[model samples]
Each structure stands twice: as structure tokens, then as C-alpha cells.
Target: MITELALRRPDDWHLHLRDGAMLQGVLPETARHFARAIIMPNLVPPVVTGADAAAYRGRILAALPAGMTFEPLMTLYLTEGTDPADLRAAAASGLVKAVKLYPAGATTNSHSGVRDFDKVRGVLDTMAEIGLPLCVHGEVTDPAVDIFDREAVFIDRVLDPIRRATPGLRVVMEHITTSQGADYVRSADRDLAATITTHHLIINRNHLLVGGIRPHYYCLPVAKREEHRLALRAAATSGDPRFFLGTDSAPHVDPLKECACGCAGCFTATNTMSLLAHVFEQENALDQLESFTSLNGPAYYRLPMNEARIRLVKGDAPVSFPDKIQTGAGPVTVFDPGFPVFWQVAQD
Candidate 1:
């Protein structure tokens, strides 16, 4: 068995570092392992304009622990009234890397999201023309559609139509949770790709519902059946450039997660690297780990791969990680893969 592995530092193509106290507490966890991350813009008010993105970026930078090197790749939340000119300026200024599309009521803090796709046509056209990628929460909010079937349905009803209409528009189907999503990205052209989260690779819907409701395992675009989890594992470990790591390590306080109305998100930033090492090893695709975690995301986003390196070592005993991360807000439960992880990132 391979005992030690080293690779170029990875970047998280999708991440949610919530504002204020939450941001300060969680930012370091991601920064410690990832050289950069595409910061999600779905805060309560949302980051809708270049100015909002810039201000958020400032806050992220300010919150970063001293001496830690990390880049927050800003994005704009696409709304019905999104200013195309402001997007152009954001792109030209090189401050914003992409625009995020959240169908209204699709996920947390998404009430301000776009309700009418037709209303955002001009914005989509401008994005295509300017080569700005559109990162999407690939699910529909229709009450008729079963929650488990939303992603597959969204592809057929929404994403396909949008792609067909707007040629050359780069799109990332974020946190894709089904074979439909994986196969679609594989069959699509270079302009399309998908982000497979760390937790999705290990957990299925059963992990969330079986025995009891595992709120920590619950996340938006919720984990699907076992077959879907297998598909994600294959895509991530197949050396397919269309798939990459995007640890959507969203953190919610324990009180919120354990309540009657729990929030949808999994806090995995603290142990993602360790989990990825175990998953890749089990797939016997350990050789392809770097491409999925480090190389592919940068290639897709048109950013350079990180120069720094990280080393993972397989130990004799199960690797130990914190069960929860304590913040001023409260205790945030860390995602437990429900399997022992024997690999850990080597300390400097």
C-alpha cells in the first residue's frame, strides 16, 4: 500500500464561508488545506453586485488568520435585476471569477434568487460574451417535483434549455448528486463541468435518513441513492477533467442543525483532505487524486494551479479529527463519514 502521497495544493471550486463570526471561525479550516476557494455569495442579503463582491472579499481577507495565505475568488449572485454592465466591470477588473445562479427557494438564503429565467436572458448573454462562468445550484424549486428527483428534472427542464439557448456560456453544475448529473457533464462539451463534494462521495440519502435523521449529513442538493454516490466516486476518481472537488463545507450551528427545522448543509472543511484520501484509496484511483482535487478545478476556472504542496500519510490507526468545531456562534458538527479514515495530511 502507498504510505505517503504528495501533490499540488488543492482549491475548492465551491465553498460557503458565511459572514461575520461564522466566517472568522470557518475560514481558517478551508484556508489551511485549500490555497483558494470560489466563495459562495448566498449570504442573507447576498452578494449581488461588483461592489458587494468587493466588500465581501475585503471581509474575508480581514477575517483570515495572520500569516495564512489564501485567496477568496469572489462571485456575484445572479438575480433578475443583475446589472450586466456591473458584471462586465467586475470581470474586467478581475475581481469576480464567476456568477452564481440560485433558482428562488432552491436552497438556504435563496429567497432573493432569480424566479424568472427569461428575466435573466440578457445577463446570461453578457456572461457568455464576456466568458464568465455561471456556477449553479442545479435543482428546481417546484413543489410538484419530488425532492430526490429535482436535480435530474432540473437538467431536463432548466439546464439543458439554458445551455441550448446560450451557446458558449460556461456552466458548473455545483454539488451534482445523481448519475444524470454526472452523465450529462460527461456527454456535454468543454463549456460544461460539475463539482462533486467530499461528503457526497461518501454518503447517500440513507446516511441521512436511516436509523435517525442525521442533520449533519443533510445538505442542499441532498445526497442521493447509493448508485448516485458510486457515480460521483467514479467521476471524481476517473481523471475526468469535467469533475473536480468542491467541498461545499457549509457550517450551521448545532442548535440549528438539531432543531425541528434543521438547515441543509454539512460541515466537512476540517477533514475533507483526510476523507478524500480514504475515498480515492478505496476506489484504487489514488493516482488520479491530484487531478481531481488540485489540477482540474484550476483548469476549468482558468486559474493557475497552486505552487505549494501537501502530503498525506497513511497511518496504522484511524486518523483522529474533531467531531465539532466551536465558534462564538456555537458548536458546528463536523461531518462523520461513518467509516474509519486511516489517512491524514502530514503536519508541517
Candidate 2:
């Protein structure tokens, strides 16, 4: 059995490091293990224009502790009012790596998202022409569509049609939660992929709804049935480049989470790598862990893979992780994988 494994440092293709104090508190959790991450732009006002992205990038760099090295790959939030020329300039300057599409009211801080897809045609067309990928929150906000079935419905009604309408447009279906999603990604021959979150691979709806409400396990594109969880595990550990890791490690303070109307997210930034090592080990696919966590994301985004390496060492005893990450915003809970994990990132 492999007890020590080293690979290229991973990158998070999707992450949420919210503004100010919250950003200061959680940035290090990811920086410790990851060399870079595609930072989510769903801030209160949202990171919309080239200038907005640049300013947000500056704040991220400013927040980085002096000794630690981490890069925040910025992205523009796509809106019905998005300016095509402004997006073009952002992409050309390399200040933005991708554009995010949130169907208005889809999830947290998405009120400024796109309600009319046609209104953003020029932006989409420019993105396709320039080869800037679109990172999507793959769920519809229709009141009629059941929450669990939204992803599947979005694929057939929204994503497929958008891809067809704009050929050469690359899309990353962020945090997919269904078998239909996995199968759809496999069926595509080009310019399409999906990101499987660490929590999604471990928990299903039963893990959320059964026994009682476990708020920390709750996330948008909320965990599905056991079969779907199994499907995600297979796709992630299958060594398929089209599927890769994007923790979607969104953080919401305790008060916001424990209230009558709770926010949707799981703060896994602090324990993602450890959890991933445990999951891959269970599948007997330790050989493929690096590919899922490190290689595939950069390949999809056309960025060079990191030269730095991280070693995962499995010890005789269970590794302990912090229960909550204290932030100026409040205490953010870390995701619990339910069982003990022996593997952890080696400091050496």
C-alpha cells in the first residue's frame, strides 16, 4: 500500500474568497495547499468589469501573507448588462481567465446575474471568438422546477442550447450533482467539462435530509441521491481529464447558516485535500488523485501546471482538522467527511 504520495500542487478551478475580513481569514487555508485558484466573483456588488476584476485582484494580493505565495486567477461575472468591449479588454489583458454565468437568483449573491440569455449574446460571442471559457452555476431558478431536478433541467433547457447557439464556446459545468450531468459531460466530444466538489463526492441528499438537518452539509446544487454521489466518485477517480476538482468551498458565517432561512454552501477550504486523499484511497485510485486535483484543471484552462509539489502522508492515527475557521464575519464550519482520515499534507 502507498503511504506517502507526492504530486504537483493543486489548483481550485472554482472558489469563493469573499471580500475584506472574510477573505483575510480564509485565504490562507487554501494557500497552504494550493498554488493557485480561479476565484469566484460573486461579491456583494460582484466583480463585473475589467477594472473591477483588477481591483479585486489587487485586494486578493494585498491580503496574501508576506511569506506565502498564491495566485488568484480572476474572472468576470456575466450579467445581462455585461459590456462586450469591456470583457474583450479584460480577456486581452489577461486580468480575467474566464466569465461566470449565474441565472439570476440561482444562489448566493447572484441577484445581479443574467435573466435574459439573449441580452448577453454579444458578450458570449466575443468570449467564443477570444476563447475565454465560461464557468457556469448549472441550476435554473424556476419556481416550478424541483430543487433536486434543476441541474438536469438546466442541462437540457439552458446549457445544451447555449452551447449549440454558440459553437467554440468552452463551458465548465461547475459542481455537477447528477448522473445525467456526468453522462452529459462524457457525451460531449469537445469544449465541455464538469467540476465535482469534495462534498458532492461524499454526501447525498440522504446525508442532508435523513435523521435531521445537517446545515453544514448543505450546498447549492445540493447533494443528490447515493447513485449520483457514486457517479461523481467514479468520474472524479476515473482519471478522465474532462472531470476535475473544484471545491466550491463557499463560506457563510454561523448566524447566516444557523438561521431560519440558511445560506447554501459548505466551507471545505481548510480540509479539502485531506478529504480528497481519503476518498481516492477508498476507491483504490490513489494513482489518479493528482490528475483530478492538479493536472486536469490547468489543462482545461490552458494554464501551465504548478512545478511545486505536495506530499500526502498516511499515518497510523486519524488526522485532526479544525471544526471552525474564525473570521471577522463569524465562525465558518469546516466540512466533516464523517469518518476519520489518516492522510494529510506533509509540512516537509
Candidate 3:
């Protein structure tokens, strides 16, 4: 077996590094693996403007361990009344990389998201004009819709019209779950891409319910049936430059996750690269691993690939699923998959 696969270093196209102590606690894991990560903007109030994004970036910088050269590519949270002027200013600053669209009630702390698609038409047009890509959460929030069907439904109701309404607009369907999502992104004319998460590529909806109500397996745009899981695996391992890595490594505390109203996220930031390598190996596509993990993402973003490198060595490596990770507020148990993972990350 190949001990290592070397290519351009990887960038996490989508990531959620939650703020404060949790940020500090988990930042190292992602930094250790990726050269740059497109940081999600879904904080309590959200990073709605250039200034907010800049300030949030500062906090991320401060929390980073000294001499670690990881970069956090910032993004703005698109709101109903979001100022297009601020979006332009943010893009002009060159710090803000993209704008995240979270339809109202779509996911965590997203109650403040856009209520109606029509409301953001002006904003979408402005984004296209300014050359800023709009990254969408891509799941509808309508309570009437079945949870599993939201993604396909959103593509028809929201994504399709949004693309038609604003030609030349760049859109990234973040953490796409269904084959419909893969098809939509693949069919778009240009500047349209989709990010497939490591968890989604490996596990199906059955994994969520098979053993039990696996809270750790639960994530927004939640895992679908095995057939969809198979499709995601094919796309990620197909060596297509359009499909790349975006470990939507969202983290929540044990209480929050285990509560009656558990938060929708999974804390996979720590073991993501290792988990990714495991999945790709299973697909027998180790040669194409670099494209999925590293090359494709930067190509889609029109950014330079990373010069730094990371190595994943295979063995009976161990990662403990701590009941709670230490945060400023007491302890927060991470959602572990409750089994021993086989891949181990090696020092650079």
C-alpha cells in the first residue's frame, strides 16, 4: 500500500471554526491539515459586513498557535437587508473571499437568514457585478418539506431561479448531499461548483439511524440514503476537478447536541483529513486523492494551491472521542462516531 500521496497541499473550501474558546480549542486540528480554509460566517449574530468579517478574522489569527502559517479565508453572511455596498467593500479589501447565503431557518443560528429568495435578488446581482461568489447552505427551511428532500427541493425552487435570474453569478452549493445537487452543479454553465464533505461521502442516511439516532452523524443537508451516498463517493473519487473537499466541521457542546432540541452540526475538524484518506482508500482511488483533497478546490476558487504539505500514514491509529472538549464554558463533549478510526495523521 502507498504510505503517502504527495500533491499540492490542500485547502478546506468550507469550514466552520466557531468563535472564542471553541475556536481556540479546535483551530489547531484544521490548521495542522489545511493551508487555507473558507471560514463559515454563521456566528450568533453572524459576520454580516466587511468589518465584522475582518474582526472575526482577527480573532482567528490571535487564536492560532505561533508560527503556524494557516490562513482563514473570510466570508460574509448574506442577510435580507444586507448592504451591497458592504459586499463590494469587503471584496475590494481582498480579505473577504465569498458571501454565504443561509436561507432563514436553514440551520444553526440561521434564523436571521434571508426569508424570501426575491429579497436577495439585488444582492445577488451586485455579487455577480463585483466578482464575488455566493456560497449557499443549499437546504430549504420550509417546515412542510421533509428533511431529506430539502436539498433537491431547494435546487428547483431556489438555486435554479437564482442562477437564471443572475447570469455570470458564481454559486457554490456547500456540502451537497444528493445526486441532484451533484447534477445541478455539474450542469451549470461556469463559475458554479459544489463542495462535498468527508462525512457525506462515506456515510448514508442509514448510518444515522441504523445503529441508533446517531447524533454525531447528524449534520445540515443531513446524510441521505445509501444510493445518494454512493453517488457522492463516485463524484469525490471520480477525479473530477469540480468535486473537492469541504469538511463542514461544525462543532457543538455535549449538552447542546444531546438536548431535547439538539443543534445541527458535527465536530469532525480534528480527524477530518484522516477520515478523508480512509474513505478515498476504500474507493481504491488513492492516486486521485490529491485532486479531491487539494487541487480541485483552489482551481475552482482561482487561487493558488498550498505549498506546505501534510502526510497521512495508515495504521491502527487512535483518536479518542472525548465526552466533552474543554471550552471557556466548562466542558463540551464532541460527537464521536463511537468506533475506533484506523487512519493516523503524521507530523509534517
Give the clash count for each candidate: 0, 0, 4
Q: Cα lDDT for residue 88, model 3?
A: 87
TM-score of each: 0.99, 0.99, 0.94
How big is the positional error of residue 297 in model 2, measured in Å on the Cα after superposition? 0.6
> Which scores greater on TM-score, model 2 or model 3?
2
> For model 2, how does the per-residue alpha-carbon lDDT over 208-252 read when each residue is reduced to its tens digit?
889989888889989999999999999999999999999999999
**Cα miss at 198, model 3 (Å)?**
1.3
Better candidate by lDDT, 1 or 3: 1
- Give the least accurate 10-residue stretch of model 3, judged by summed lDDT: 329-338
Distance from true position, residue 293, model 2, in Å? 0.6
Off by over 4 Å in 2: none
lDDT of 3 at 115: 85
Deviation in Å, model 1, residue 278 alpha carbon: 0.1
- Per-candidate alpha-carbon RMSD to the true structure: 0.7, 0.6, 1.8
The CA lDDT at 305 in model 2 is 97
lDDT of 1 by residue, 1-348 (tens): 898999999999999999999999899999998999999999989999999999999999999999899999999999999999999999999999999999999988999998889999999999999999999999999999999999999999999999999999999999999999999999986799999999999999998999999888889999899999999999999998999999999999999999899999999999999999999999999999999999999999998899999999999999888988888788888899998999998988
For candidate 1, the 10 contiguous residues with the lowest summed lDDT are 323-332
lDDT of 3 by residue, 175-236 (tens): 99999988887787687888998788777888888857877777898999988998899889
The TM-score obtained by model 1 is 0.99
